[model samples]
Target: MHTAAAVADFHTYPLISALTHLERLPDQLRVQWADGRVSPFHYQWLRDNCPCPQCVYNVTREQVLEIVDVDEDLVALDAHIEQGLLCVRWHGGHTSRFDPGWLRAHAYDDESRAERLAAKPKSQLWDRAFEWPVFDYAALMEDPAALLQWLLALRDSGLTHVRGVPTEPGSLALIAKRISFIRESNFGVLFNVQSKADADSNAYTAFNLPLHSDLPTRELQPGLQFLHCLVNDADGGESIFVDGFAIANALRDEDPEAFRALCEIAVEFRNKDRHSDYRRLAPIIALDALGEVAEIRMANFLRGPFETSVAQMPLLYRAYRRFIAMTRDERFRLVKRLNPGELWCFDNRRTLHARNAFDPASGARHFQGCYIDRDELLSRILVLQR
Candidate 1:
């Protein structure tokens, strides 16, 4: 076996060369990250009520390993790539050879990694808004802490909302000041209400619509979406939301090929309404380029027909089908309603949002919203000290 000194060479290649996603593992359970880093995670749960008899006593065995009983760093060691194999040196100095082929085959391909772990979607419920402080347009114009808190919540609920903002139609422009860059859309806040003249809805499209993202085909899509509700009728017209990141993640786990295909092909998006003229080309599935699910672009209506090289068409079609199936899957969709005076910000890059047609039946439905460049938003969050 090569000495540990020899293994350090593996770090020279891109981290993607060293790391791998073990199909279907749970917890912060990255078996091997692109950086040749390894983290302990057996399943998806973050808190470890580990039921292993060694960690937890079998009721019959009656000997619980108390918190103080276990060595915290379970097994710490560095790894080296030797003879095409990535070997792990256990805390005790013992070593194990990991099948190098298995690691290489899936390197930089998290879909393969997800399959190894067998992760799937469970019924996740998110209805009301988040408990964190919801700020007014003026406060948000100054402080973005509330938005940050809601964003971090994605670790669990995969979605969040900011409620009770005193909406001033002009407030959206100030709100845009916080972001690093803006993705100006043709329709910053276009409206299509429930009217007796409406076509699709047998009943004037009155009910709130299902959850979906704003754009699905832009090669670079808006990373954040903020809507400041300017007016709310005495009755309906609440905003609805679903967590797209979680849904895409669940799909990645259930089918690797489908996941891979989605990443490889770009879906066309077009908006040719009389008032709007816009078009985009992007993948239905997006990644951080580091092999993680970063965003999901799923807009059935916005997507234009596939136009690709003949050789790429069949493969592209296969991927298109996969995306459609997953988007329609109810298990992957979580729903929520947003009330007026409520300012909701969704990770335009990661979350999908929608709203139903409000009933003019009782009152009017109006939302005054604007765009904030994602770069601006992130810069506000990550201003560096150095």
Candidate 2:
């Protein structure tokens, strides 16, 4: 009996016994296991994904066989399980060996596809009771484990607070460089968030700012934002934040039609200045290929004129109003006052941030801010895990 013990020295599927039978179809190969599970593989697919030293470089582990080099009408001349590996000989005088364990892992059947889609990374939505993750700046700089934990928190929760940071100018850039290079925008590498009389952007003023994401006009907006508080002896300028993804997911479950409208309708965002005229059109609620919330892009201040058809205007406005109302609701908003030596790092694409109107005469409020790409944070976490 050809059982799992027959190929115990080689990699084998967990729930599947050694290959009990192989049936070669006209254009595919089917394998049956002792557990009664059947997996099908097309001749072309097996040929394309051959795990051999010749077809795949051993050092780089990359495929050397170009798709164009393969014969379009390729067929498996013979296929059988040998030493727990699926050995296939093509009609083109080529043989490929595939580990059954690898084959089971890479199956493209409906069940496998559904399982993969369901296992995607999901955000931990937060409300008023959500406690912001706080990290020690010194530990993050000196300890790798601390840094990894901080990055993971930022990835899963989309926000964190770092206390005991140096209250110096341009300090935010140093902290951002630990993960990756700082992402510079039209606002420069490190921009100051203080009241300026001649400020072109509303963020540089003491006016009451609404909850919004940054740089929605850019085609690829910055993913992460770091704000370092140097001075905050002001009054009524409390920091406001709302998890856009959380509210978006709620909107999806409660008012699916409204969610659909926001996802389908593209709104224009623009930033006009003496130096540049940046513009782009994107949906407020963006989703990944698997229909999960990937990012949220909404900026009331940067929103340009509506360009959709006149008939679709009502649907778009209704959805837009509903979303904006949810974001502004007190239930979803978190109000905090940042103090000196404290810094905030948050997902620019997932969190909507705001600031209340402050009395500039009461005291000065200054913060230096910078941006970093989200991929850098994710990459660092992966490397640390390995």
Candidate 3:
């Protein structure tokens, strides 16, 4: 039983003072905070989340007590506030202690959950006129602070330009290793972006590649892409970029039905060759749990035939065409000529990339490319901040 003396001593425990009341019910416990917010926790949940050394390993941080070992109908026989912690003695002779701060931090009430979800960082949408964020490659490679700022710019704007990189082979891989290990695919660790005699994909040709995301056929697409221009003395191989998220949001605002269809219908993406065959079925626009656009997968060259029902085929095509048109719109597309010694990096999941047709006989246009997962870039940013 809780006593008045224990409650009076809460002033020393600032966390305990936040709790206005605690009600021990038959199967669960309800805590009313000083702010008038009520949070409920089941007995089993509290037991599972117990921070005591007996229940959790102190060094490994792993849970020692299995949920099956606890009684399914266990109840708190007695509960009290002791030294800023909520102490509970269970019916089976097991005791648990919970810090009020932990409880408040891990609150799962409707209001708390909503607030947490709303606090997530949102990407800043951009159009063709948006100025590209540029950083010195030498400074970024030498200084940790410059590297973090460049990475954050990529995270927020979905694109960044790094100039003054040494124009040489394998430079892209070295730059990529600064953030994390390169994400290797069938193309190899460091792929060449030059015209080939018999190209496996359109990206290897000198033809004007349509604006699209890379490797959509794979189940797990690469998150970040690095393209280092070693030689771009060509006539007309200008680079093009479009923000897929911006176009996706525009579709959602202008034609909600089209947006819904794109999000609901799953299309097939396939990459088949003599040596390898990869395939995946995914929606063009993937929404997160909060119904916000999380990723955009669009690759016309790799997109296979629609496998949806005949009735839905027309709707899917309409939405697909609308999205493709939006990507090509001059207002959304940014065209720039990447010069030698310049490195371009962008979010592969958010930015659609393309190239203009160049005359192979005009001059040489060579680039080294590599990929890194999105999580790696984000992790580096967090560690740098610390």
| CA lDDT of each prediction against the hidden true structure | 0.53, 0.86, 0.86
Residue-wise C-alpha lDDT for candidate 3, range 1-386, written one tens digit per residue = 24322221212223433666789998889988887889888888988887677787666656788989988888889887776578889876888877676677567888767866777667999998999999998898899999999999999889999999898899887778889999999999999999998899898999999988899998878999999999988799899999999999999999999999999999989988889999999998999887888888988989898989999999999999999989989999999999999988999999999999999899999999999999999999888875
Q: Which stretches of model 3 miss by more than 4 angstroms?
A: 1-21, 34-36
54-161 in candidate 2: lDDT tens per residue?
787766666788868888888888998787678999876789877666676677877666766777566889987889999999999999899999998899899899
Off by over 4 Å in 2: 1-21, 32-36, 58-60
TM-score, candidate 2, is 0.88
Candidate 1 off by > 4 Å = 1-159, 180-183, 188-210, 234-236, 274-276, 308-322, 328-330, 384-386
lDDT of 1 at 257: 73
Q: List the residue pairs that clash in candidate 3.
A: none
RMSD (Cα, Å) for all candidates, in order, is 16.2, 4.3, 5.2
TM-score of each candidate structure, all chains considered together: 0.55, 0.88, 0.88
Error of 1 at 199 (Å): 12
Clashes of each: 29, 0, 0
The lDDT, on a scale of 0 to 1, for candidate 3 is: 0.86
Say which prediction, candidate 1 or candidate 2, comes out ahead on lDDT: 2
